[model samples]
Target chain A: MLASLGRGRLLACAALTVLVSGCATPAFDQARALHHAGDSAAGLSVLISAQDTIPERDQLLLLLEQGTLELFDGQSSAAARQFVSAADYIDAEDRISLRDEARALVTSEATTRYTGEYAEQLLAHSHAMLGFLLSGQAESAAVEARRAGKRLREHEDTLDSATFTRALMALSFEMAGQTNDAYVSARALPAGTWPATAARLAQQLGSSDADTLAPSALNNALASARGELVLAVATGQVSTKYSSHLNNGLAWQIAFPAYRPVDAPTPALSLQLANGKTPAHERASTNINQLLRQSLDARAGALLARQSLRLSAKHNLAKELRAKDELGAQLLAIALFVSEVADTRGWYSLPARFDLYRVAVPVGADSLTATVRGKSYTVDLNALDYSRGPVLRLMKF
Target chain B: MFRSLSRSLALAAAFASLALAGCAATTRAIDPGSDIQYDAQYSFSDKNAIVKDLTDSLLNRAAYSADQAPIMVVYDVVNETSEHISTSGITDDIRIALLQSGRYRFISREQRANLKAELQEQGAAAQRVASARKLGAQFILAGSLRSIEKEQPKQWRLNRKKLVYYSLNLEMTDIQTGEIRWADKAEIARESSQPIIGW
Candidate 1:
């Protein structure tokens, strides 16, 4: 009996050590650091290699990061394929798995499959739209727009209106000649936050809002230009979630997920056109960090309730073991404490914010240079065919 | 004590064998025509139903000369749905059905580029081959696929319900006159319910 108890204690200590060490480092930390260092190709390679080693439950997170890196690397078609696979997986795993939930109650929330936050789900479609647009598949981009609109409507009651997605949807619909749908999406844009191009489009489609009817030089240039160029710039890294532990004086403690704020400055962008023309206007479109914080705030009540229940469950198990063997109870308590970790997984490759710029190009203009954070990136207009629709370019800093 | 230890080892081995057997993968074949609703998203059965309905409609309603088969070209079938569907698959099946029925003649859309390249190569080589003549298509067949999906509102419920409606619209137009000679649409609406709790 003594030898058996020793063996059991050794196994328990080993399991506890594994659980504690696993929570020491958050997922995607290395890849995110590499991406922030301006080597997105290396970051993408890390994720692609990890696909063989990571658990199947984490595949959605891997795909989201891989898709973002691929998009930044100018592999638009490959990025689109990744987003499509992610969307399909999200659809297939729509239901909550009871088995995983039960296991999570005893273990940690990390044991459950990462189904993705609502913001991530919506952004998947948004990124897919950009992917298709960048690849010159305007019709496929329109399809993604429709899908994002559906998801937005489903969560409108809880989620703040995604202004950036709505702008892209309107542009996609206009490019596809779905005038009525474009007007609808344009109308959905919040007042005072609508981009200049979206407001002009709404007004052109006969919007009754007085704000949209105001005439401006930018709108006039946009209306008269032979083609328009849309530039989207992403800057800074989003704040990461960390495990926060709360302990009482007794043998009771709980772990919850919390965000460590990141300081990301607004990027300044200036365009120098070959024809000496300037961009019509620029605006900050989406703040992903803010969205993430709001989503976590909304779930605070449920998370607290679950943590309370887990504490009670662990305490009861320990008490029952104590009635049988005091040493066993103590060992179980130590193991439970180590295993109670918070789920801090997320789509970490997303930028802190997105900014949009609209430039009107004359028929013969061939190139332009955009300077962000003192680094100039040139876009060659001669290589792109603008007769189809507006040309989109993405720059990351 | 030795006897008890041996019995314990035997029990452990049996349990391990049972767990391994449970993890083994198995495969079987099933009829393709059977309706299998795995989820609310589209499936192979939906494709078959749409193809069958649309092809039947086209074959029965097409207006053409009784003695001469209409020479046609299958153009782009645009996908306007939320899901990524290969619209070409639908058009390919329709072309096959029309040809097998002996009611329509199709100019190969996929082989056009290869044929053009082959003709260029022959011309460059100056080979003594018969002159290749390209046939002109009289009618163009084109279509679009669209879908609408709705989910049950978030509330206290044991199951979530989703409804998806898909429509495929096809038309045959006279290339010279720019007139639509035949048009038809096939629609499929399905509602699926998933349990909120399962083990």
Candidate 2:
């Protein structure tokens, strides 16, 4: 009986190991070792083998490494493929987040003293992107160009961040002889809030031209934009201490579309977006002041403006996406759409030097997701007309 | 001892009577063993190139065309050799290529796998509206590896010699239309000069 029991146990143990022989094993170290040894060939082989052995996440990491190597090895098309393969392994949310973080790093200012409090911490990032672009390697230019664009896009987003946009707004206020501690703020604006406002405007003027937008609506939008800007560009102490710019009760006016692009000669508000390669001191000369005005004019519609009422809203991208009609729907679904995001920050000039300020964060690369009747869907809220008056106006087609 | 042996025989006979079934390899006319097996190894140079080329073809085909709304096509190479090839090895390559194109984005495996799981768990509700299949990748690639065998006998003090041959066949086909859009075959042949070798 004892012998039989022992035999049975032995058989069970043997069976278990054999069954689990096909189970996953860790391969990260081996892949790393091979890759570092300059044996990309061996490293890739091990990676392929380990995809069958390692956890799914490791496989993603390996693919990321492969893409990095390909990019470094002057095979960008190959590199792009590797990145896509890695993307395939991760969730959409994670993909977007990681890519977004990477993008942020690209545009992030270096640890140099742009202000006393904010050292140019993201300088390495600037160098990295520029290195790729300047490498003079032909095969890798496409990959490098993509990186450059990411940094530029992120720089433009400073006009959207809690620190930068607010500061710019403060500059505007300061230049206009107003007291301010810059603070930028952002609140999730639900789609339900816009339709009624839009309907009211649509009612005010049955056929208002693009230039004839209502002063009341324009003021509300401007006040909101200024409020948001105050929070976006300032620093810690300044953000909390600054006086807010958010206001209400504007005089009435009409708003309509203007500057039909694709038919128009060019993007009306084209600004030289800094790709993090530009010096901080050079920023003021290149601020989106010109771009912002064009954006306002184009978005507000000349027809509304011709009526002598300024249309005050950060609706540049939103208007553009909508103008594209059916073709733009997909893009609109992904962009950030909000009347404004408001916050505040401290001003850090070089070191031991600081001041309070306020800013407004604009919606860029922002988006909206909604659930109705147990169904999940998202819309590019920024793509919607700000004055449509809150009622979830969906795709026309 | 005799009784024990007798019992074993009796049990075997009982099992035999239960219509025990089996399978076999058979042929009617031609010699069935046309396949000759051989293994080949290449230096680091060849290994690197092979993976790169194969991956490029696979990824470019999958991403640019398959994920498009209207759907377009490109060619891919398929491996049909007995080396236990996985599409992921190559498809992973394809994914990287497409993402870098700046012109295309890939449908990630995570996305596809999640869709599969969601569909399974939620049963139709999960797969509604968004589908990875929306990217129109209509073509798939495939290929095979084969070898040839030859032998020679006696030269001076040497007794015999053996040779092994290899060939790789690659093809791309329209998954929906069942058409072979393109085909190409590359072969690697080797003649081993072995002295005093026979099998």
Candidate 3:
């Protein structure tokens, strides 16, 4: 009887191990690999094919990744659709689910629905804005810009101001012929964030600036240009979270997810006209890596406190079972340890930094050359239907 | 002792499995007019209410002769709100209600393209007949939807509250005279609270 009981306990332990391991498998490894290999189309295909395999809990992350790949694949309309779906899901899931939270505390955070980090949520709106602008839906783009601003305001206490989204909002308002609204957005931009562009836009929108009173040639060109060409280039990959183990001389070790250190310099992209006249270079408008770090930092205290509570609960349970049955206690301890794996899943396909370049294009100007990371690529402005408003072109590396 | 331990282990395992499995999803039909609100965001109740109120206001308030229904074209309702609301839905509902009341007439904006295509296909023959058959709208119906949302500031609280107010202002303009003849607005305001901590 003793031997059979021991065998039964071992079998139960094995079964628990299998269940935990199945849930711990990362969902986006294959998709991320294909995306980083410069095959976003293939990456998008993999995600679509694996839709059934992806748990409902990870649907938000999947949508975000698919949207990014779609945008990179030059399917802006399709990308916009995906982002809209994501936004809908986010809106519907705005309230926390008690059931999911309960399950997360007992099992793993991965078991809960991925509501999305604050940065990811804001970027969803920003990307949707870009997708609509590129597809010549200026009205839809303006709506997304307002949505992004609303989200920023909702989380103003926790998140830093997103300069990229603010700039896009100003530009979208301008395209939609809401000049007063556009001026409001432009003036709201933080000082020294987009110095030249903001000043020029504010000045053009009738914001009298003593500093910009002198009429420079660039100002004249911008004032008389037929349309503006906006280039957004994404460079380098954002850092990923990994499982971190902590052994504090306790019976059970604590495991949590931590972001890997990313120390790369901000990347820049410069645009030059067909006549070899280089426009003023602007600093990177957004640093997603920093945003991710700040988001994680903001939640660190909560995460650690939850982990501590979980440790105590598991330890107490194991200690009680040890007094009743030695073999069962051992089996339970093993099961708990295996199930303690961190939830490191996240939107891994995002770029580390975003560089935006805006320049006024004269009539009949078809294309311009963009130089980034010692490589030059010709961007076609004529392909876009600029009659609606300013045209946008995106590049990823 | 071993039996009790086995029972205890089984109970714990069952609890863990239940937590992991979660509750299965279920769906049931409810009355469309039911005022059920899940959050501060817009809901179907709001849509239903707006359509009913606006349709009633337009039908009762507009100055028109009972001899004949005024010819009108329902233009686009610009969505200036943050949400991706299909303002067309509101316009479509209002149009349906007005037509059913037999108090108004509407020219289909979507069918205009088909009408143009048919005229082009028929060349000169259709144009000769179209000039006499073409109906000109006397009033143009247009509007815009806007919203103002306010969120509770982050603080040490057990619940977070959000308030959203939506205003849909619609108007009828005299096409020839370029004068606003009628206007009305429907508004919805809702507040929702969500618990910060969940079991």
Off by over 4 Å in 2: A1-397, B1-39, B42-47, B51-91, B94-105, B111-136, B149-165, B175-179, B192-199
- Reference-based lDDT, residue B113, model 3: 52
Best by TM-score: 1
For candidate 3, what is the DockQ-based docking class?
Answer: acceptable
Under CAPRI classification, how is model 1 graded?
acceptable
Which has the better DockQ: candidate 1, or candidate 3?
Answer: 1
**Residue A6 C-alpha lDDT in model 1:** 59
Error of 1 at B31 (Å): 4.6
> Model 2 scores what on Cα lDDT?
0.32
State the lDDT of candidate 2 residue by residue for A7-63, as single tens digits.
335334334433332222345455545544445566556666666654332344455
lDDT of 1 by residue, A1-397 (tens): 4234554764475375447435522336677778878888888888777667777668888888889989998998899888877877786687778887676776777877777777888888888888888886777888888888887877775456467777778777776656667777876777754456556666666766537355665666767766778887787778888889988754877888888876665556778878777756545377778777777776789889988887888788777767767877777777777777788888888888776666777666778888777878888888876665677888887
> What do the candidate models score in CA lDDT, each in turn?
0.75, 0.32, 0.75
Candidate 1 docks with a DockQ of 0.34
Error of 2 at A303 (Å): 99
Worst 10 residues of 2 chain A by lDDT: A230-239
Candidate 2: docking tier: incorrect
What is the TM-score (0 to 1) of candidate 3? 0.81
For every model shown, what is its TM-score relative to the native structure? 0.85, 0.19, 0.81
Task: Give the runs in model 1 whose Cα sits over 4 Å from its true position.
Answer: A1-14, A17-27, A192-219, A223-226, A274-277, A281-284, A363-366, B1-36, B110-135
